[model samples]
Target: MVMCKDVVENIIGYIDAELDDKTLEELEKHLDECPECQVFVRTYRKMLELTGKLRERTFVTPEIRERLKQLLKSKLKPN
Candidate 1:
């Protein structure tokens, strides 16, 4: 079963459409039932779009991506 954390961990790949077929299918199914995740995904997409229009483009390496995932997971965690 795909959990919220799974969504967060895989979000980068999900947005890039780089996930394997099975993972993508599972993530989409979870997204369909989870309003919070849907909102998160939309907001993330908008952030990416805004950033993309900037003069300097940030190249995200695997290390940076891992850090981003940790940052996002921290933000999403309940107090």
Candidate 2:
């Protein structure tokens, strides 16, 4: 079984489906008995949900992409 601390750190990757099978299994086993990890997982999932909603709301406009590109280019330019 993985330690609670490691599971907490990997919670985001797990929720994002970025974890390998072994890591996922460890996290799952830990979450099974650990309420704190379960809550962390729930909160992480809710954050992802909110982020998706925010992205849908903000990125539907072409202006945001253009503005982001402009900002990046400005930041990347030599002073």
Candidate 1 has which clashing residue pairs, if any? none
Where does candidate 1 stray beyond 4 Å?
Answer: 56-79
lDDT of 2 by residue, 2-71 (tens): 8789887886687679999988888788889999888877887888788888755644468888899999
Residues 1-79 of candidate 1 have per-residue lDDT tens digits of 8988999999999988999999999999999999999999999999998988985767898899999999999999999
| Number of the top-ranking candidate, with TM-score as the measure | 1
CA error at residue 47 for candidate 1, angstroms: 0.2
Task: List residue ranges in candidate 2 displaced over 4 A.
Answer: 56-79
